[model samples]
Target chain A: MTGTVWDRGEPRLAGPDTALRAELRTAAQHASGNVPVAVATDTAGQVLEGMRGRAFDSAAVVAVLDGDRLRGLVTLERLLAAPAATPLGEIMDDAPPVVAPSTAQERAAWLAVQHAEPTLAVVDDAGRFAGLVAAPTLLGVLLEEHDEDMARLGGFLGTAATARSSTTEPVLRRLSHRLPWLLLGLAGALLAAVIVGSFEEQLGQEVLIAYFVPGVVYMADAVGTQTEALVIRGLSLGIGVRRIAVREVVTGVLLGAFLGGLALPLVWALWGRADVAVAVALALLAASSIASLIALALPWLFHRFGKDPAFGSGPLATVIQDVLTVAIYLLVATAVVL
Target chain B: MTGTVWDRGEPRLAGPDTALRAELRTAAQHASGNVPVAVATDTAGQVLEGMRGRAFDSAAVVAVLDGDRLRGLVTLERLLAAPAATPLGEIMDDAPPVVAPSTAQERAAWLAVQHAEPTLAVVDDAGRFAGLVAAPTLLGVLLEEHDEDMARLGGFLGTAATARSSTTEPVLRRLSHRLPWLLLGLAGALLAAVIVGSFEEQLGQEVLIAYFVPGVVYMADAVGTQTEALVIRGLSLGIGVRRIAVREVVTGVLLGAFLGGLALPLVWALWGRADVAVAVALALLAASSIASLIALALPWLFHRFGKDPAFGSGPLATVIQDVLTVAIYLLVATAVVL
Candidate 1:
């Protein structure tokens, strides 16, 4: 027998609210209450008769409710395949995957994917059924988030619309999307110039030290970029930076050592200046090792502050890495060469 | 009256092939042919009875077939709402979104999303029904492709598996994923060093030029990275580079002019050298403008060769931008400052 089944009049589906849709992009915002619902004791034939004239946002699955609470879910396929006299409760999935209405849109979509459920159920704090996030909405969220992440990682303002319009967007709109990040990058670039200017004395004495600046900065950025991509993807999948920080930093150091070992002899053989070679190799080691740390740390900070972690990957993080790489390269050059 | 219909005996579904699944991830590879299928003339009651005893990979949508040829599709909700004697042809949607079995998985998923359909039908070259790609499979494909794009854009070897395993992956395995690109980056870096070395005479005469090397290179890489991300996302969305090339290059030049205008006065005031400032500003303009051209071209070449265009975004493009920036900076400095 079904436990505590209470009928609450007719099953009225929730309708879209344009005002609420304009708010935070949460599960509650996207969850549509327009799906079909049935009472547990209803026979398949009875439910089918009731559904005949009603419109549903999604009819793939039906929520079986006991009063105001969700009891289980039954896919329409199951309902069609069952005997006409079979009770809804007998064919319903009693433990379908459910999330609170406050869940992040990406997290909600991810849970649906992990559960391999076509639609996700959203329940309220008081354990009342809110609605279901249908397949199309879930698909839209995934694509939108993908576009946003790529835009943020590429240094464009994080707008889902930007990704779609970027190809055909007028040059002015494209500039508006790309300029904010580049301006920030320019400030960091000037700061890098200041840092190098402070090291002009050493460079004036040993002009060879200047030759490796671009090389060193480029290598560190390459290493840091790899870490940023890994961390961003991991974070979106519900893995935190703290979980992978140690291993990632270690990978950075090992990579530095490998690259440095190769560079030391190569620079010495090509340039025939052992001190310059040592400085360049050592700078590569330090810059590469620190690159991953900064990469992981910036995203972690952004995540902690409730910003998109992907914002830490592109222009902002690149500038930070460039400044630090220049400082490390010069500080090491001054130490080893002069 | 319904169009010409042929009967092809029993509706047997295609089974998974392990060998084929290991090859190129395509629509055919992930599609499940085990979905429910019914002839157009079958009654709702008859189709329901036929589906009762059979197993289906996905029962969300039933293919309405004319023999082996697809006639239409019917969601379970419509079938459930119909009278028992209602022929499926009356309820079936004759124009459901569909793709060839050889279509790319991403394209198939996009079609499903565009059509707002939970499932996609796949047909063979000769137009026989091949399978239905279920919602879950489409969701998985989106997530997998997202991870792969992030990995490739972040400069990790382009492997979908690498994105999932990177967080918990052992350090050695991590190195394997990261080193191939870093080695290529190192070669590029050393080449940058050679480019800088060729400018040693200019640097010794005016050591101030060395101060802007990191700054200029960083800015160009930042600009180039934005275009790369835009181009990569655009390419995946089926927008070819040629469509956006003129507008993108124009945006790049405009961005360069804007950044250059800002840098010129600031450098002159900070360093009190108009020649060095002019060189820096002009280099900024030239480097920033060329960055987008290289960014768009590399990815276009990769796409033309049937490679994943995401590869053109990260270390490869960055190094090319860096080398060119350095050469442009010194060339401008020699022309203006000397």
Candidate 2:
């Protein structure tokens, strides 16, 4: 039920080793070569007869080959729409999006999605036609990629393995999958404590300073998360980080100003401390703007370091945001409230 | 570049109204009825001839109809593999997953993914065939749904509207989109401050108690976020909340115990205060466990209310976790140290 239930072409079994490796080629498998093929000179009538004589597994798109080299592709829809006497060359999409057989499965799926094609043609290094990746295989790749991204963002140990595992997979397995990030978070937590401890004198001067620590950190994290989500999805959809940098930063500052404005009055009304309110408002403005910038920069940094952008989304980014927020909040409290 | 580049059947122009509404029929555009459909009584050979006469935009799946009454579907793959003399009735998939035209677009996409089908047949109330939803349409829907889910989790204003807008969308527009959640977060932040203020008497008794507030809150939020990601993806994959509830809870507790165990000694060593250490560790364990429960329950509650489960993921969950983490940390610190 784990893998075969959604079997398009690959039988993805739920096992410990099902974790997709970082290699782009790991996702691409050899196609069955069962799709219908025709020579460039074949007439629609001749292609129709050839199609009838053979038991091809998929003929959604007929590959037009010149001996071993693919020249073009003709969707079955086009073939059916054409007069039987028309030559295949006249109706074929001559410039179909072709990819190397070793291309990352995710990229291959993206190419198909970008072109809105249900089938993709794979070519070998020498420009020889390998086979067609059917719609199901492409769909499976898309779904798997989606799961992997979500898993990375969730801080799972291995996305493909854990996502495939039944809910009842061993507790030990769950622990092993989750502990790495939680441990990283633990280190961040300790650092937060130390940072808070450094401001002990300031905190002692004004007990109200501690009241807003969690609030500021949470808000920064929230703002940062929105940026992370946008950047991750945008990068995948072909929008580069450099394209939206200015707009995102400006949005961050504006968001800070608006949220801080609302927060200032509420804190003052509730606490009756003008200094504390000012400190809270200042911290909010600073932390929020910084959080948005960090959110955009981290994913871009991960991408530059040859990592998935999602690697920067979860605990790692949140920890950094928390530390900065804590420092900003306390420093402002020291200057304004103390 | 609007729709032709992605050439999925619909030409999705980048517009302010692209956010998919809650209706399913919005995504179900009229299929050009140009796909090669046939009556169940027609022979494959006859259907092939009939297909040659019409201009089909897609023939990946041939609808077997009886005077507009939907009979079954025969994939082009299977048709290619069958003897041409065979009748459509003998080769058709009789039990295709059919949805009403009004079914939610996301749900329709899910049904297609779960069934591993490339084409979906939309049937009317009396079971009359509307038309075929081709593979490109299904792929588009999946990608859109993916974007929308990510946007909601990231706390975006309107997924379709904002995600499609170039990151260069006006700062005012960006502010408008983000301010709603940030505003919601501001209210939560003020409430957190008030919660902390109520415990000021206890905090004054031990100044060191304030150091762990941000750390504790940050760690619980990290854990809760992991759970929220899993539950959101899990629910979409057809895993019911009840099935994984117990396992998730146990995993959360075990995570809490392990992290808290490590943190206890570390805090004690750093601060030379066993009482403070014990208080921090106890709060971590309790808050971590509670965080997981809240994470799971919030999405479930939203799902129960007929809302998108992702609505429970970002700021709302974080805000709730923050308030509770602050309360628990201070209460534990007061009990242990004071």
Reference-based TM-score, model 2: 0.84
Q: Candidate 2 - CAPRI tier?
A: medium
Checking candidate 1 for backbone clashes, the offending pairs are none
Q: After superposition on all CA atoms, how large is the RMSD of candidate 2?
A: 7.5
lDDT of each: 0.82, 0.76
Per-residue error (Å), model 2, residue A11:
21
Residues B1-338 of candidate 2 have per-residue lDDT tens digits of: 01000112332222233334342234345343445667777777777666664566677878887776778888876776677788889999899978766556666766776688888877766676667777777766666667667777788764436354635577787777777888788888878888888988887777899888888998898888878888887776557788888988998898899888999999999999999999989999999899999999998998777667878887788889889989898888899999
> Model 1: what is its DockQ?
0.60
Query: What fraction of the reference structure's interface contacts does model 2 contain?
Result: 0.71
**Number of the predicted model whose DockQ against the real structure is largest:** 1
lDDT of 2 at B317: 88
Off by over 4 Å in 2: A1-22, A25-43, A55-57, A63-72, A88-111, A121-132, A160-172, B1-43, B63-73, B87-104, B107-111, B121-132, B160-170
For candidate 1, the TM-score of chain A alone versus the native chain A is: 0.87
Native contacts retained by candidate 1: 0.72
Clash tally for model 2:
1
